[model samples]
Target: MTRCDWAENANELMTRYHDYEWGVPTTDERETFELMTLEMMQAGLSWQTVLNKRANFKVAFADFDVTKVARFDDNDVVRLLNDAGIIRNRLKIKDTIHNARQLGKWHAAGKTMNAYLWAFVDGQPIVNRYLSMVEVPAQTPLSQQISKALKKAGFKFVGPTIVQSWLEALGILDDHLATCTVNHLSK
Candidate 1:
């Protein structure tokens, strides 16, 4: 089956992620938070690296439970920094904790990450018809707007490029190549 060119030569884990998870729409708050965290962790690193250490991240971040992670203290930060299984970036680690607290505040206000994000696209994925990976952009105007909103909302490490990737990863933006078999929009 034809896959996106980037995923074609990837390792088994990445291949599976491409086929099964990437660009799949999800409204689950936990899953949304987890994807956002993973995207943030991927800054200055490869997605493959993040995927390689995903299990460790899940364990380290309390399965991406917003409340649990928001409660992570200085001791937890130190533990994450010294953990060999995940990325040891202090900024990303602390940012994850801070972002969790922001999410917690949103939760208290009866807002959900899923709803906040999907609202950008009117609750539907923006299906793109690019014929090749080259046609896919690194960041778009929409991403920039979203990044600005997120930053204003107190999220860190969420620049436009990262926000764009996170949007794509969450299926808010479906960027699968039109020629690829996994392009559900094409089908």
Candidate 2:
């Protein structure tokens, strides 16, 4: 079977995420929150690592429920550190809760996460036809703009690299390989 150019490994998890979730536009506030949190957990780590621990991350993160995660306390942080299924980094774990709180703040400001996020692309995906894996970019001006806005909103772990990946995953940007079917399909 074929896949997106970025998929160097066609393992089960990668394949599933690529086929079903990657590059698919998601407007759900909860999902955007989850992706943001996961991207933070992925810092100094591999996407595959996060994917392998995804189930555990979901459980530890309370199924990516924004309200519940935003309310997590110090005790909750300790509980997460002891959990074997997810990454144990204290800062990254704490950032998850921090991001959730920011999400709530955005909502209170009358801007849903989905709306605020998708607005950077003007409610359309930035489709790129990369001929090879190396041809795809790590960051774009749009991602930079969003990253700046996210930081201003008091969100942590939203650097340019993470923001760019998040946008691609959320389908705000499509970096599918030009030869890949989805590249032409999305256009």
Candidate 3:
């Protein structure tokens, strides 16, 4: 079976993530929010770490339910910090909960995160051709704009780098390699 071309260092977990989830269009608000939180938590950490504990994160964060996560309190923070299932970082855990609350506000304002986020690209994915992994950029002007907007919208942990990663993961930015088996949109 053919698979998406990935870096040689990618292990089974990363390979699976790249094949199944990377550059896939997603419109679900909950899924988008979940990935946003996960990516934020992945700031200094590797994507593999986030993927490995994704199930645990879902359980701990109430399946990424915006309402529930937005309502997390001090006690919840403490619980998450002590939970081995997810990352034990206090700051990121707090930011995750905080960002959920802000996202809820945005939703209540009749502004869905999907709509708000997709607006950066004028409601379309930005396909990028790359010869290899090194050719892929870490941040782009589009991501910078999105990051600025997200910060203005009161989101935390959403710098340009994280926003770029989100764009790629959600198919807003397709960074598939030219020779990738799953290079359908690379052309």
Candidate 4:
């Protein structure tokens, strides 16, 4: 099947994520949290690696349950540190919990993760018409704005590039290349 250039050579795991999951708009709170968390884990790493370890992450992080992950404490940190199935980075592990707690608070305030995230682009995905991967940006002014907002809310690993990737993955910003077959179909 014709695909985005970045996904063209992807392995089975990455291929499935690209074809079935990436850039698909979701309104589910859990789903949104999971994608955003995975994007955080992807900092300084490859998407392939995150894809490969996703199942393990789900298992280790209590299926990405915001309440459970938010409740994670010192013991959880030690446990995650010893878990070889997921990324062993201390900062990432800690930040996952931190973000989860923040999410929990947001939920308590009646804010759904998907809804809050979609507000960034006015609840519509921005479909880019770039013809090539090289034309896609690593960061944008919009991304900067989002990153700033996320950091203000006490999230970590939410740099401009990381937030941009999260936005793309969540379908808040569709980055599929115009030359890519999926670009037209990605929505």
Summarize candidate 1's per-residue lDDT along 1-187 as a digit string, tens digits: 8999889989998888888778888888998999999999999889999999999999999999999999999999999999999999999999999999999999999999999999999998998979889889999999999999999989999999999999999889988888778644311
Let me know the TM-score candidate 3 reaches against the reference structure: 0.92
Candidate 2 worst ten-residue window by lDDT: 178-187
Clashing pairs in 3: none
What's model 4's TM-score?
0.95
Which pairs of residues clash in candidate 1, taking residues 3 or more apart in a chain or in different chains?
none
Over all chains combined, what TM-score does candidate 2 have?
0.93
Candidate 4: stretches off by over 4 Å: 183-187
lDDT of each: 0.92, 0.83, 0.84, 0.86
Alpha-carbon RMSD of each model: 2.0, 2.2, 2.6, 1.6
- Full ranking by TM-score: 1, 4, 2, 3
Candidate 2's C-alpha lDDT? 0.83
Compared with the true structure, what per-residue lDDT tens digits does model 2 show for residues 93-181?
A: 88888888888777767879888887777898888877788877788888888889888878888999899889888888877776665
Order of all candidates by lDDT, from best down to worst?
Answer: 1, 4, 3, 2
Tens-digit lDDT track for model 4 on 49-142? 8989999999999999999999999999999999999999999999999999998999999987788778877888898868888899999998
